[model samples]
Target chain A: MSVLAFPPPVESEAAETLRAEVRAFLADANAARTPLERAESWNGFDREFSRALGRRGWLGMTWPKEYGGHERSAFERYVVVEETLAAGAPVAAHWIADRQSGPTLLRHGTEAQKRAILPRIAAGECVFCIGMSEPDAGSDLAATRARAERQGDGSWKVNGTKLWTTYGHEADYMILFCRTSGTPADRHEGTSQLLVDMRMTSGVTVRPIHDLMGQHHFNEVHFEDAVLPPDALLGTEGQGWAQVMGELAHERSGPERFLSSIQLLIELIGALRGSESLAAQAAVGRLFAHLVTLRRMSRGVAALLEAGDDPTTHAAIVKDLGATFEQELPDIARSLVDEEPDLRSTSDFAAVLAYTMMAAPAFSLRGGTREILRGIIARQLGLR
Target chain B: MDDVSSIIFESAQRLLSDLSERVSAGRPMADCERADGWRQIEEMGLPFALMSEAQGGLGLSDAEAFELVRICGRNVVPWPLVDTMLANRFATQGGAAPAEGPIDTLGELTAEQKERAALARAMQMAGALDVILVMTISHVQERSQFGRPLAKFQAVQHSLAVLAGEVAAGQAAAEHAVARLARGGAAATLAIGIARARIGEACSKAAAIAHQLHGAIGYAREHRLHLYTTSLWRWRDEYGTQTWWTRQVGREVLAAGPDAFWPAVTGA
Candidate 1:
């Protein structure tokens, strides 16, 4: 059994070269971008920009070369992700696909399934959305009522609605979770995952759900008799609970969790450069300290992942702490700046403040609610 | 560095496990005080890890030291580990043999005998110092309000979080510095400054909070918790407060420019 240990810090030449290459790419991209001249960080999703990243072989830096990946070390990918998030690049378009979906496919998808989709994802030509949440099921993922029934033609008919689907309307496909057998009464035992081609499906409907900022990032997706090939099943039927739990490990812990609001912090610090107030300095120092702790913890998780360890408990810890920091951005910013918080203002400060305030609520709600995450932690500690 | 750190951490973890078991076995807190704790740490060669091979100690770096300190923080291993490490670095920089036993430098003294005298006075005034390492920035007099202590205020609560952050950062920086000094770098000065600032901040904040929370009772020695809080306040102001180190960091940063700020802070 391999015990989890911190991987030696990336000191090899290849790692350094990758870091330099990524830094150069981010510098150029940050310079060229204009109209959407805002630092949306994790929220900003641009398909063209994602494709550009793909062209540079950055989107799938750590998958097998057979699937159009560079097969780089996870540490190298760690550098790229950190730099990208820190630079506030528009990464949401390919974030889910690159981070978890592609990996999940590699682990569970059949050869035909792999050959058909992995390369396109690696190339950033195809975008994917998670079809996990249903109208009734949020954290209770096993409670999804989306049903898939076997047809005489060796295919499956999927029917139900998924809510809060990020980029559902824009995604080419969705790695969806649905019931293959039994009802919610069976919960984990009968659920399974399927990769559905949104373009070819005729029964699918998508409607944008405007967030507080009026952004159409999330949507309500409906599937009425959507036909999927038998091969669309990601893994064996009735094994989705295990598959998704593994995938959640990937989703929960990452540089993105703690870094979403870092750009705003950088901007805030820049504006406070000449200020001599003790409160402002102390507040900034406090934020920096918390940031350091979050980074250390998140890096520890990454090290665990590199060591091929299950770090679900550690991931939950990072998510909870990260959400707290992200949610506190506006309050911290307000205390630092002398001006009023306004979303519509043309100033960069106003724009970032507005974006952060609007985006902050979802920080906890998106991946997992604070209550849910804490419950997981409590369970891990055997307190529940 | 990686191998050495892994070995040290594993050993430290084992030691902590044993200590925790003992604590759970109804061992009194005072029974495991500085003398025994320092011996255990010394036997583990932690102070040696804080020094360089050139200085007759195990060679390490800031990053390695940080890893050690992080583990220590997570376990909440109560001892003057950070303080002793700071004292060792100070002694090494002064071209003196690193102190072999527990040494708590008095914060309110300067000359060696005076420092010893101050520690003695502190022991007389309050209690004993396993090792008193005095710092240079001692407050002239206690600040008071309306014939009452000035430590009580609603603003103090708001400041505690910031105070904790500063202390954490300072301790982190000190750990980093000792690692650098072990590798034979001129980081002892920086480490001392950070240690002074961090200790002072922790002390003052703890004092303010303790006084506010305890009210007039904090002034009474019978309140045992006050000992911990007051010792922190007195010791914090002994060497240097936040104001002193803030100016020092400012001077260093101004001389180096914004580009060097991160490298300086991170000891890169």
Candidate 2:
């Protein structure tokens, strides 16, 4: 069998209608936002905008209705997401919460925990951050040292730090993956995921870590003696590794993975519209070609995920392939267009180019690095 | 329906697994040899894959027909299944005679015929790449260096992973093109262009890596690698090179302008 066989994307009138609905919303919602701001898209934080989508029933779409979700198909949710990202709507405020937190809670959260958090998440009134990467552990995620020791009263105290926590400062909650019972030498053992409410926790401090682009979204979230109730644990204790792995399929394959650099492609088309260069035309055309294939693969993953199949391998391929296309785009755009990367330029193309060029590195680096992803694929191929 | 598809795929696979050896030695099948392979398939009713029931054909879906073409490509069938399928499909559709014998070279083709042929080539290349990936994996797994198999090495594993990814991408591209082109709408033309262009790129990247991983042995013309690699090198440039399809679709997208670009892409 081929190592990658993504089922063809499923399209329905319902999904297409949702797509149109999302586009109509974006046209009005993104009217005042600058192109540069829209370019940020999923990373462009706007609580009000996230709630607007929530009220429209665009958030927590695939979850069960009892949890305040719309109980829609994954394909329908996928259409809404791709439209949002393709139009570059500001989705950062509720991205993590809607994408992973709610689903993780559905799968692993206790009844009370699900009742308390899922409704708020579905309403887009709550925000969540991932507490995975730490000071000494980025790619070696199992090397996590952040320990959440059990207390005598059956409570838990979390003491460690999580680095590169996106939107940590603004988050109302954080899914804290930490060592629950064992040492760092235990590798993936003795680890558990905790639901840490940022407001409810007293010892948590979120410090801004300016990115290379002088952005302040990523933060260092410190848990100094942060205590949690016994119910804070997500899923079975000591099963953090498996749960996190499941969450990754959600994170790695999505519209945003491929659509992150879409603004540049839009700008490239605008710049190259009337050009007589076949080289430019073909290069630009090939990008769209790659986009469609990646989109199919991603949608296939979504379908598999909805059907309760493990799409981890397929998801990895989408992320890897999508990131490659996204990162290569800026250079291809630069070659086709004469404009330099200028963030402050009056030209929209140049401004989009400037941000995308700088942001390109993170395309492969974030979520999972190039090497790690390839390794996962290799393992799937039975090389390991 | 799926069972019928699989039956077609399996029979093709069983026949091609043996027939591929004729070309694996880096030589075209002689007329007699080609005839034998063609006769075997003719008996099995594969050439009728794309025709409708009224045409006395198997009435397979376009996706299924293209998949048969893909199987032909996988075995490096040294004859003309693609040309025959297209010729017969278009001929019977237009109420003409299907080609009588095993086709080696194509006759005059229309621009639309050419595009369909390109889609066929795209799937063929995808199939050939899939074979190359399997061959490369086998090579790395069984062949050893520095007291361990190449598959045991991280560098080799990573390279093979990239090759596998390319192979998958090419397959997905061809399949995506088939899905859209079968539907036959405004997006069909652009879909083929995109798929063909992307598949050509995949053929290049994957063939090169498959060769690199095989080292000096893969360079041998007698090596079975040549069958798949050479086909990719030739097929990618058949109806159109990567850039040809790219420019064709790109110009259309450009003329559509930035505002209409995304809508055209999604076909919404």
Candidate 3:
């Protein structure tokens, strides 16, 4: 009956300094963005904004400076990320790249791959999207049927579809996880990740998938024997399953996981201000309590990751519980306030509430679904 | 996880484990049992965990003291160890010394005191959930229904899973509060306020689910589940109810204004 332990996040002088710097930067940068746009939070894409962050060396914060990184600590990067997410900064352009792709590449990429790609990622010039979920393989990523065959010329040719690919159309590259060998029955066997250059590839096509929210943030990316050079393989051949599993820690541990509905929360606070409603106060306070706990858990994982702990189960716990909070935020807001959520409303609170309500459904679905994460958690608990 | 902390924690864990086994066997905390438990905890030096060496205390780190509380919570120790530590912390800040007794006077819980008490209570709830969860899981595994062990039911497993999530939430909130208090940051007060509010909110759902999953046996006086659930109900409203802390935290957050809200929380 072992329970999960989330240690207090270790304080750092560097993280404190970076936090102030990032907050100041966000205040200035987000001055022009409306509450509706800020409500979009991490999903809001802005390439130039990403570039501005890159100039400040925030994009590749924890990476080594020789590859255009700032050589900062993970805690320092955490501060920047939490500040950016809380301020509702448009970080979509460089988020996936900075969060997982670059780290994955840094850990497993060849020297050439790291040199060619990590610097651009650090500069926020190169945007990346994940190529994990296929139409038939979402949470069951091992069910991936996307095949990458080795050509006689030593290059690879990929053919399959990747669904729910966020920023697929705008991405400069993708860390494509595909079956290098073995059947779908093999589950996790003979998989490999490809560092596919979207711009250089000719047979790839990205079609936008409008979500329930009428947003074009997601896409269906197709590959038709898309050719990749010999160097495209990340880590080892036939080890993509393990490699991708290792990278889930990076994907799951960020502050962005829990802060998705922060704009709505901020707006809710404004609407509830000076109100004599005890119910409203309690509701908002409950949400804030969840937020603080989630942040602590998330930050604890960040610190654990910094200390070179795997924290895979810890990360899953954060994502699962964090999504629950994110999805619940809008519902709590709707209940506490009388305002009808209207996406096009002139009221900042209503507009943000609308945006949050529409986006809330995706919280548990993205990164990983609640059921899948719970299964992982149950397994971690030795229950399955 | 330092050497001294681990040693202290191990000793406390052993004592608590023994006490927990006895309580499980005894079904509830008798007055004599409660008094003995307090003596043991005081002898373990937990009350002075946060007090300085000059004050004849170990003065362990806040994280270590919180860890001890978490362990005690997990076991449902039925002692006022956390309360004593709170009293000691208060007294160390130039207040009246804890009254001379096996336990110190907790005094009237101010907003900060209430929040601290809430965090301690939250930890207890988390611990109690852990005990109930294990008990329920064991019961479901052993007790048969419909020609199969109750654990075979998907509904039972899912309910237990939900219980696990609640326990996790409570534990996370308590730890977060303790961590913030340990840091003594400007937002520490607000952080504790949020922690108490959230944990208090979770109390009902956690208690209800545990009882529901346990069935009639859970409500029985001899079953031992009542020991935890009843304590949870009592402590949940002790310092401040979720409503009290929520309004307190919400008012502070609102007063800070919308623009300052993000920085207030993040910086905390």
Candidate 3: docking tier: medium
Each model's lDDT comes to 0.64, 0.86, 0.80
Candidate No. with top DockQ: 2
Question: How many angstroms is residue A275 displaced in model 2 relative to the true structure, after the best TM-score fit?
Answer: 2.0
TM-score of chain A of each: 0.95, 0.98, 0.98
- Chain B TM-scores, listed for every candidate in order, come to 0.44, 0.92, 0.85
Give the Å error, residue A366, model 3: 0.7
lDDT string for model 2 (A39-119, tens) is 786789999999999999999998888999999999998888888898888889989999988889999999999999999
DockQ of 3: 0.54
The runs of at least 3 residues in candidate 2 whose Cα sits more than 4 Å from the true structure, single-residue gaps closed, are B2-5, B22-24, B27-35, B47-56
Candidate 2's error at B36, in angstroms?
Answer: 3.6
User: How much lDDT does candidate 1 score?
Assistant: 0.64
Name the top lDDT candidate.
Answer: 2
Q: What ranges in model 3 sit over 4 Å off? A: B1-9, B24-71, B76-119, B136-158, B182-188
How displaced is residue B4 in candidate 2, in Å?
4.4
